[model samples]
Target: MNEIIRLEHVSMAFRMDLNRTTSLKEWMVTLLKGQHRHKDFFALNDVSFSVQRGDVVGLIGHNGSGKSTVLKIISGIYKPTQGKVTVDGHIAPMLELGSGFDYELSGDKNIFLNGAILGFNEKFLQEKHDEIVAFSELDDFINMPLKTYSSGMLMRLAFSIATIIEPEILIVDEILSVGDAHFQKKSRERMRQLMEGGTTVLFVSHDITEIRKMCSSVLWLDHGKIQMYGDAVAVCDAYQAAMI
Candidate 1:
């Protein structure tokens, strides 16, 4: 299989301010008094991984272990402080629910808004609009303002738009756990269909059952480093063993 994504010696660092002052004057005073300081927190350290075309990979780790950071780096949300990341083909990243949505706008408007954010042209979104709505099963609420919608409704809208045009690479981060059980089941089926149609999927989830069922390979991260990277069953089993 051809490689779809690669990260080489990737490291991400975030700046943290030591000063607690909120105002510019206070901040300046602290700086002048030599009280201001800052530190860098590395989220990923020398991390490297690759995903082949049509691979279903799961990223599993505890909170703050940098699973989401890896996704963001791949999605170009955050540039690595050091190292290299390469991606080929169009990407549909459902990294967060309701992202790129204007809550004040109607759901129909958000369809186009999110579609644009997903890199689709207006005409293409218009053509796929009906199908997206149908898939969302939110026909009655499509014209309502998004602020009036529930979390599940919002996720439904976002998921529908994101999947209207199947992207070459699909990146999901705990989004499948949002909706009701039925909707979640439906969403998983849709994801499976997308994978079957040759879309590469790399997802981050704490649910080991979902990871095992959906992924062929697993990447386990701990303390901002790779703990394991290999076949899903083997890696997951090892991770579970370590957790216990």
Candidate 2:
């Protein structure tokens, strides 16, 4: 397998204000006095990893462990504060459902809109329109405005469009159970199909069982640092033991 994703000492940091000034006047006063309390918080601390083409890798960590930060950096939603990151394939990120959508627009229009945003041409979207709708099971609500739909409905449409492209690299962030139990099963089946067809996948999930079952390898993170990286069972076993 060829290397498709790599990170060299990649680190992401954010400047967080230590003082919470309620008024603009107070904030300006602190700024002028050079007393604006701020500190750099490292979300990813000199992290490094590589993933091969056609590999399914799972990222596991506790809340606020920077798992989402890593995904955002890999998705180009964020630039690492330090170190180099490289990706050799096109990425479809499902980090935020309906993130590319226009709420005022009808679902049908958003389909074309989101598909275009994902880099698909009009002709291709037209060809796959029916299939996407069928998979989402949103035939009745396809004409309604997105603002009128429920969160689960929006996620269904987003997942349908994103996976329909069969992207070279798919980034999923805890969206396996996007809808009801029925749709959750369907989504998992679809994800399995994508993996079987050799789409490189990097996903973050809290469910260790799902990670061990779906991922060939696991990247365990703790406090923005790598805890383990190896075979699914091995890494997960280590992480689970540590948690206990």
Candidate 3:
């Protein structure tokens, strides 16, 4: 398989203020006194990886190990503080629940809005609207504002929108189980179909069993660094053992 995604010596750093200031005046006073301090927190440190086309790669890590950071960089949501990221295909990223949604707008409107952000034209979204709603089983709530919906409702809408386009690459970040058990099964089957149809997928999940089952390869991250990267079964087995 040809390479579809690659990250070279990638590092993402954020400036964190050391001092907490409650008000603008206090912040200004600290700055004027030269007492303000900031530290660079590296969410990803010199990480390198390459994914081939049609690969289902699972990212496993602790809560703050930069798994989400890696996905964001690959999805173009975040730019690395250092190094280069290359993606060769159109990406459908379900990085976060309701990420591209307008909460105040009805779910109906969000369908078009989010679809456009994913590079679909209004006409295309219009054509797929019914199918998306049908699959989500959100027909009753489709005309209601998103802010009123529960988390499961949001997940259903987001998953429907992200998968309807059949993108060349799909990026999922710990969202597969957000829905109800029935929907979870449906989503997993959908994911399997996508993988079988040769969609390159990069996903972050803490569920090692799911990772081993769905992934052809696994990338284990720890403390913002790669701990292991190899065959799914080998890396997952090592990661599980390390967790114990």
Candidate 4:
């Protein structure tokens, strides 16, 4: 099996400010003490994993368990403070809906901009433009500014554009909760198609059923640590047992 992604002891930390406001006198006092006003929050702690081609891996964790952080690191949106992240192929991250979208721009314009951000060249997107628009079902509003779109419409457009061009690795983060039932089914089918076509998927979601149904393997993360990693059913069962 070919490896698509490798995370070697990756860790990420952020400096968080405890106090929102500081008086001049307080700031001067802190300066005299030679101290900055922040505390370190470790988001990901020495996490390591490898994904192989055609693997559909589910990441299950509670809020603040570093699930999204792992996706961001794989997508190149966040850099690790400690080890290395090596992606051997093209990656498409569907972490945030309409993340690269410019609300002020027309949907058509945002399509090109967002596609480029996803690593598609102009020629490549042009070839898939009609398919994306059709899948989004936004033909009537395609010329309108994206700010005018409803949340569902925005999600449809974003998902359509993001998945139109296949990548070697696809990273998704609980985004299936955004659209309506019909659209959600369509999105799931599209993801299945991508997986069948040999794309590696890194899926992060709180929906255990979805994870079990879609993933071949599972990783359970708790408080920035791996609680379980193995077959989908086994890991998912372990997670459920631990939660009870």
Over 114-222, each residue of candidate 3 has an lDDT whose tens digit, in order, gives 8888788988999999999998999789999999999889989989888887789999888778589999999888988998899999988888888988999999999
TM-score, cand. 4: 0.91
Clashing pairs in 1: none
Model 2: which residue pairs collide? none
In angstroms, the error of model 1 at 140 is: 2.7
- Which of the two, 2 or 3, has more TM-score? 2
Residue range 123-192, candidate 1, lDDT tens digits: 9998998999998889889999999999889988888888777899999988776578888888888888
lDDT of the structure predicted as candidate 4: 0.88
Which ranges of candidate 4 are over 4 A from the true structure?
18-29
1-244: candidate 2 lDDT, tens digit per residue: 6999999999999988888788999999999999999899999999999999999999998999999999999989899999999999999888877788999999999999999988889999999999999999998899999999999999999999999978889998988878999999999899999998889999999999989999999999999999899899999999999989
Model 1 steric clash total? 0
lDDT of 3: 0.90
Output the worst ten-in-a-row residue range by lDDT, candidate 2: 91-100
lDDT of 4 by residue, 1-244 (tens): 8788889999999778665336888777777876657888899898988888889999998999998888988888898989999999888878886889999999999999999887799998999999989999898799999989999999999999999977888888877755899998898888889988888999988889989999999988888888888899999999999889
C-alpha root-mean-square deviation, each candidate: 1.6, 1.8, 2.0, 2.2
TM-score of each predicted structure versus truth? 0.94, 0.94, 0.91, 0.91
Clashes of each: 0, 0, 0, 0
Q: Give per-residue lDDT, candidate 1, residue 43.
A: 96
**Model 2: per-residue Cα lDDT at residue 39:** 92
Local lDDT at 38 for model 3: 87
> RMSD (Cα, Å) of candidate 4?
2.2
